[model samples]
Target: MSDYSSAFTHCETGNLYSLKSLIDHVDAQRLGEIKDKHRASLLHYAARHGQTDILQYLIEHKKMDANLKSENGATAAHDASVCDRLEALEYLFHQTELKSNVRDERGDSPLHLAAWYGSYPSLKFMLEDQRADAHIRSYDGSFPLHYASSHGHSECVKLLLKVAPDTVNGQTIAGLTPLYLACHMNHLEVIKILISRGANIRLKDEDGLNCLHAACRNATTEVVGWLLEKQNANVNDCDYSNYTPLHYAASSQHESLITYLLNRGARIQAASNGNTPLHVAAEYGRNGSCALLIEAGCSPLDQNVQHLKPSDLAQQNGFTDLSNELKLRERSLIHKALPGSNITSVTSVNDSVTQHPKTSVVRLVVRKKNVKRADVSLQVSENEIVNEIRQQSSTPSVENDTNRRRTRPFAQELQAKVLEHEANSRREPNNSDINQNFNSSHDSSQLLHSLNSINQRNQAGKTRAKLPHDVYGPWMKNLDPDTFKEQLNTVHAGLRKVRRNSLVQQEKYNSDDVHVSSAENEYTLVDTSNSENNDNTPVIEESIRGKEFLNNQNKLTSKTESFQSKSGQNTINSGPKHNQFTGDKTNITMPQWQKELIERKKGIKA
Candidate 1:
C-alpha cells in the first residue's frame, strides 16, 4: 500500500475520496501502522498541507505528530503558519506534543513567517495561542515588531508591541530600533506610537548614527523636523567621523534640511577634521550648499588639514565663485595669511641614544615650549593616547635605519619649516615633499585611524618597543614577507597599545597634545630615533599581537575594531549575532520562505 503520509497528502487537496476507497479495502489497523522512514504518520501530511478541513479530519482520526518538521526544519505547524490559515494554525498550536520553539534552520518560528507575510489575523491568533514567541528574532535578527515596522503594518506593530513592548524598543542586529526603522520608512503614525510608548530617539545604530541621521538619509523632511524638534535631538550630533547633520545635509544637498537646521541654530561653521561646511561643500562641488553656508556665516577661509582655506579646495575643484571670493579674501589679508612655510630647518640635536642603541624606534617626546616633562605614562587618558598616536604617526621608524641616514636632516628641516609656519601664522607647503620616499607613511583613512589610536596609547605605560618602520627600504635590503607582515601587524598593535595606555591617564591632561591634527588629512610616513627603554601594557599589546598572529595563520581570530574618530564605529561585531538585539543589520538568521518552500516541494518529489 502507498505510505500513510502519502495517502494523507492525497486527502488534503480534495483527494480524500480516492484515498478512502483504498483505505476501506485495507485494514484500519494496517493504515494506522503505516509511517514514513522517520515515522511521520499519515495525519502529519494532512496538517502540513494547511487545508483546514483535511487537517481537522487528520487530527480527529489519525492523531499524527503535529510538529513533525523534517531533518531540515519544517513541521505541520510551519506550513499552517506560513500558509496563513489561522484556524488550522490554532489547531496545531493547541496540540499537546507540539513545541512552541521549534526553529527552522534559520531560527525563525511561526510568528516570523506570519508577521513577514502581513498575515495579521493569523499572527494575532498565534500570539493569543501562547504558542507564538513574539520576541523570537528571525535569522535576520528581526523581531515581529521590526518586521511589522519595516513593512508599514501599523496594526501588526501595535499588537506585537502590546505582546512584547520590549521588542519595539529593542534594536536589531543592525543597531536600529523599531522606532528608527519606522521613522526611516516615514511611518509617521507608527513612529508616533513608538515614541509615545517611550522608544529611544537618541539610539545610535550599528553605524553610530541616530534616528535623525536615518531620517536624513531617507530625506524625510517632516520626520527630520519631528525628531529634531520633538526629541530635542542634537542636530549637530557628530557621526563616526565627527560629522554633524549639517555636514551630511551639505553633502546630500538637502536644501530644506539645511535650511531647517540653520534656523534651529545648527552650526554652519562646525568642522570635522577642522573642515568648515564651506570646505566640505567645496569638496563635493556643492554650490548651493556653499551659498547657504556662506549666507549662514560659514568662514570663507576656514583652514583645512592642509592649512589651506576653503578656497583652496574650491579652486582645486574649479569652483569659480568660491575660489574668487577666497582669492578676494586672500588679497585682503595677504599680509596675515600668506603661504611661506617653504623654509626648512634641520635641528642638530646631540642627545645620547641610550634607549635603543641599535634600533631607531619613534619615542614620544612631550615638551611644551619650556615646561619640564611630567611623569605621566601610559596610564594616561584616552584623549592623550589618541593624540599621541597622531603625533607619533608622523615620526618615522622602521627596520630600514639607513633610509633615515639618507633622508634624516631633510625630514627634520621640513618639520622645522612646519613649526616655523605655525609660529609665524604662515601656511606651510600643502603638498608632500616630492623628493622624499616617505617610508612608513600613513596615507589612507584606515591607516590614519590606526595611527590616531597609537598616539593616544603613547601616554599609556610604554608597550614593548614595536618594530617601527622608520626605515623600511634601505635597512632590510630584502625584507622577509613574513616579518614584513609581522611589522605591519606590530605597527597596528603598537598603535592600539599606545591608545590603551593613554586611555588610562589623567583625563585632565587628555587634550594636552590631542593631535586631532592631520595634513590635508594625509599622514606622511615619518622617521624617529630610538631613545627610551619601552614600557609594556600586556593586555593592550597582546590583543594586537594575538590578532595579527591569527591573521597570519589565515584565520580571523577577531575583527579589528575601527572606531572612527568622534564616533565609535569600530567594525566590532556590534552585529546582531553578538548580543541578539543590539548590534547592526537584521542579521537574517534563517532561510527565506521561498527557499524553504522549494525544499518542501523537492522533498515530495524525492
Candidate 2:
C-alpha cells in the first residue's frame, strides 16, 4: 500500500510501464484504493492530465471504478471535461461505463463543467458521443445553457440549444434566464443566438428588471442598441419601482447612453421615488451626467418625494460645485427668457453667497418685479391675458393674499379703462359702418366666442377669489332665471339623448354598424365592467344592462320609501319599527320559546 502511492507519480507523468510495474507489486484488492488531498484517486489524476493509457490500465486491469466520485462528487469524466482532455474524455466515453451526467459537489455535471471551462473539443465529444444531458440544472438551478451563455461560448450554447431548445429560456435560481445572463455578461453574440432561438427578451428577473435595464447598468451600449432597435424594446418601460433604463444609465454615469435614450424619447422626467434621472445623477455625484441632463431641459426645481430638489440632493451629498452649477443654469434660463422685463438682476451665485448669509443653503429667492399695471399692453391677446391670470391664480397661499388683493383693484381699473375706450370707439360712425359692412356669420360667431371666453375667465377669477376661511356655498346664487332654465333644459336634453341612443344601439342589434346605426353618430359611454369588450357592441350591451339594473333598483327603493313615509305618519306611536313590505316588525321582540315554537310550526307545514 505504501508503494502504491508511487504509482500516482507514474500515473501523473504517463509512465505506463512504471505505473504497471508499481501497481503489479501492490495487492490486487488494494489497487483501486488510492486518493490524494482532494480525495481524487490516481484515475482522477490520469483523466485530468489526459493520461488515457493510465486510465485504461487502471479501469481495465486494476478494476478501478471509473464512476468513483471525489470529495466534490466529481467523477473522472467531470475532471477530464474540465481540463479539456479530449482523448481522455473520448476514451472514458467509449472504453468505460462512466456516467457523464453525474453531478459534482456543486451539482455541476460533466456537461456543465465542459460548458463552463470552454472545453470546445471535450464539450462537443460529450454532446455528440457520450450523449450528455445538456438541460441538466446545477445546484443553483442553472442549466448547461446558462453555463455556456454566461461564459460567452456561443458554439457551446448553440449545441446545447440545438439538443434542448427549451433550455434557452431556462432560468437560474435567481430567476435569470439565459438571455439575462448573456446580457448581464455583455455577450452580444450569445444574446443574439439566444434571441434567434426564441429566447424571451421581455422576461424580467426576480428584481423586476429586464435585459435592457441590466445592459444599461453594465454600460453595454451595443447591447442596449440591439435590444432597442432589433427587439423593439419599450424605451420608456419602467421596472417595479417605475425606474426607466435612463435612470439606471444616468445613475451609472453612462452619458452617451443617456443621450441615446433621450433621443429615442425616453422620458427625462420619468421618476422613481419622485427622483428623476437628474436627481439620481446628482445624488450619486454623477457630475458629467448632471451636465448632460441639465442641458436637455431638466428642471432643477423639480422635487422628489422628500420635497428636495436635485440641487438640494447635490448639496446634501457634498457636491457644492454641482449644486452651484445647477442654480446658475436655472437662473440663466430665467434671465434669458425675461431679459429687460423689470425682473431682478440675475446675481452671480458667488456674490449672492457672500452678500446674503442665508444664501449659504442655496435658498430659492423669488424676487418681485416692479412692472406697473400701465406697463401691461392693452394690445395683448385675450388668451394670453387669461393664461397669465390662470398661472397667477392657480397657486393660492396665505402669504400671497395681500399681493392678490392689491392686484385685484388694479385689474378692475384696467378693465374699466378698456371698456371706456371700446365705448368711445363704438360711438364713431365710421367704425360702426365698417363693422356692419364686413361682418359675416363666421365673424359674428368668432366675436361671440371671444365674449363668452372672457365671461368664463371672469367667473373663474371670481371663484378663485374665495377665502380659505370662508364657508363654501352654492356658486349660482346670482344666476339669471331664464339663463338657468335654458341650461337645465340643455342638460336634460343631453341626458335624454344619451339614454335613447343607449337603448337604440342595444335593441337594434345592427351588427354591420354597431357604433353608427344609420341614424346619427355620437359619443358612447364605455362600460368598465366588460373586460372582454372586443368591439362597441359588447360595451353598449353591458352599459345599458348595468344602467337599467340600477334604474330598476332605484325605482323599487323609492316606492318602498314612499310607502314607509306615508305609513309612518299613522304608526308614529306603534310598538316597533315596521317592515316596509310586510308590516310585521314585532317578530324580533317575540319570546325565545314562542319564536322556537313558531319556527317548528312553520317547518311542520309540509
Candidate 3:
C-alpha cells in the first residue's frame, strides 16, 4: 500500500522524487484509494502548491483525477485559485481539462476566491487568459466585485468592475452594493475605485443602514469625512429605527468620529423613541461620547418616550458615576439659563464648592442698577443649594429685599415655580379661582382676601354636626330606671372585658420581650380608635355614662321636692351641706363621658 500521508506531504512541499517513488510502488486501484482527511487526492495538493512536475507525475504516471473534490467540494483548480498559485492554476487549466469556473461547496468560483483573497496575479490571469466569468454570483448572491470591494483589493475590484461594469451598482441578496461593502469595511482605495466606476453610494441594506451608517460602525473617521464631504452623504439620514450615523458613532464610543460627524452638521437633537444621541451614549455607558455630546450642546435633559432623562437612563443602566456627572452638567446648564441672576461665569461653581470640616461661605456679589451693592455670603456644600437665606441689612430697603430673595438658588426654586406656573396656565377656564386668577394682574392683598374667603367657605361647609344630641335627648328623657340600669351594667361589663384584654396583651408583650414597631403600635391605636366601628364601643360607653348622669339628675329633683315638704328649720340647718353638694355638682354640669369623648376627638384630629 502507498503511504498516502507521506505522498500528500511530498506533493505539497514539491518533493517530486518521494511522491513518485510512493506512487510507482502502488497500482492504479490503490492510487485511486489514496486520499487525505478532507478526501483531497494527490493532484489537489500538487496543483495547490504550484508543484508542476509533481502535477505531471500524478496525472500522467499515476493517472490521478484532476477534478477530484475535497469535503468542501474544492477541486484542484479551486485550491490553486485560493492560494494565488498562477502556475498551478495554469497547469491545471492547460495541461488538464480542469475548467476555470468550477464552484466550491459554497458556490464560490475560482475567480470569486481569487478576487476575495486579493490574488491580483491569479485574478488577472483568470480574467484575461483563462476567460473565467467575472460576473458569477455566489450562493449569497455576491459577485466577484462584491468580494473584491469588501476585502479591500483595489486592483481586483477595478478589474472586476471593468469586466462587469454593470455589476458596480449590482446588489447582493441583502441589498449590499460593492460601494456599501467597501465603506463598511473601511476600504478607502476600493471605495475610490468603486465610486470612480459609478458605484451607487446611497444604496441601503436590508436593515435600512446606508453607507454612512455602516462606516460609523467601525468608525473610520477619514472614510466618514470623505463620505460626507466628497460624496455628500446625508449625515442626518436615519435608518429604519431612525438611528443616524451620530447615533452609531456614539454607540461605538468613537469620539473622533462623533466630533467629525457633529462638525459636518449632524443634528445633535435627532431623536429615536424621543432619545437623542446623548441618551444613546449614556445607555451604552460611553462616558467619553456622552461628555462630547453634552459639550457639543446636546441637552442631557432631553427625555425619551418613557420620560427618562439621559441621567435617569444612565442610572437605570447602572452607570452611577456617569449619571451623577450628567446631573451636575444639567445643574450647570440650568444655572447658566436662569434669567437676571447676573451669573457671568459659573464654570467654576462645581469646582469651587468642596467639602470642608467647617462650612465654607461662598461670597456672591450682586450688581444691579440703582440697587444697593450687598455682598451675600452663602454656606453651600458640593451639589447642595441653599433654598433661602435671610439677608439682614443695616438699612433695609424694598429693593434690597427683592435682590436678597433673588440671590438664593434660582435653579431649583425658579424651575419649580416656572413648572407650576405653566401647569396653572394650562388649567381649564372653569377651574378654581387660584387657577383663574394665576395670570391676572390682581394685587397681593386681593389674592390673599380671595384665598381667605375660599378657606372660610370650605370651613363652613365642613362643619361637624352637633352629635345628634336632640334625637338622643327625647329618647333618654323617656327611658325608665330599670332599662337605664341594665344599659349601664352592660357598658361596665364591656369596659371590664376591654381592660382585661389590654392587660393580658401588655403582660404577653412584657413576658415575651416582643418589641412592637412604631408602625404596628400606630396601627393598633388606629384600630381601637376607629370611628366607624359597627359595635359602637366608644359611642355606647359614652351614651351609657350620659344616661346614668340623667338618672342622677332625676333623683336630685325628687330629693329637692322632699326637702320642700320638710320643715324650714331642718332645711336651714342642712343649707351648708346642700351648698357644698351643689357647688361640686356645678363642676360636673357637662356629662363626664361627653367631655372625655370631645377631648379624645380633638386628640385624634391633632
- Among all windows of 10 consecutive residues in model 1, the one with the lowest summed lDDT is 534-543
Write down the lDDT that model 3 would get: 0.69
User: Can you write out model 1's per-residue Cα lDDT over 1-606, one digit (the tens) per residue?
Assistant: 354445755756757666666564655456556667655555555655656666655555544445555544766676666667666677776754665567777787777767766778888887885657788876768787887877778888888888898776788777878888877777888888888888888888776788777776665578889888777889878777566777767766677778888898787544446677777777777777777887786756455444556656765666656556554543444322323323223111122321222323233443443454442222233235445555555554674466547445654555555454345322221123211212222233334444444444544634435555656356545678998788778877776554433222212221221111123323221111111322321111112243343253222112433433324432333221222212232121221222345446547766
Query: Across residues 1-606, which tens digit of lDDT does each residue of candidate 2 receive?
Result: 455677678878999988876667655457556677777888888998999888887888877778787888888889898999999988987887767787888999888998998888888888887787786888899988888888899988888888899887788877899898888788999999999999998889887888888888775678899999999999988888788888888888678888898898888754557788889898888989998887787767565656667766777777778877877876775555444445465556566542343333433322225545333222233234445555565555776687667666755655665465456534423422433323332344555555555556566654334334225436445669997788777876675554444333333322212121111322233223334555632333213443453354343222223323454542222212222222222111112232345446546763
Off by over 4 Å in 3: 1-3, 27-41, 269-275, 282-285, 299-606
**Candidate 2 Cα errors over 4 Å, as ranges:** 1-42, 57-72, 94-97, 251-253, 279-287, 298-606
- The whole-model lDDT of each prediction reads 0.59, 0.69, 0.69
lDDT of each residue in 158-252, candidate 3, tens digit only? 78877889999988899999888888899998888888888777889998998998899875799999988899899999988788888889988
Q: Is candidate 1 or candidate 2 better by lDDT?
A: 2
lDDT (Cα) of model 2: 0.69
lDDT of 2 at 60: 82
Best by TM-score: 3
TM-score of 3: 0.52
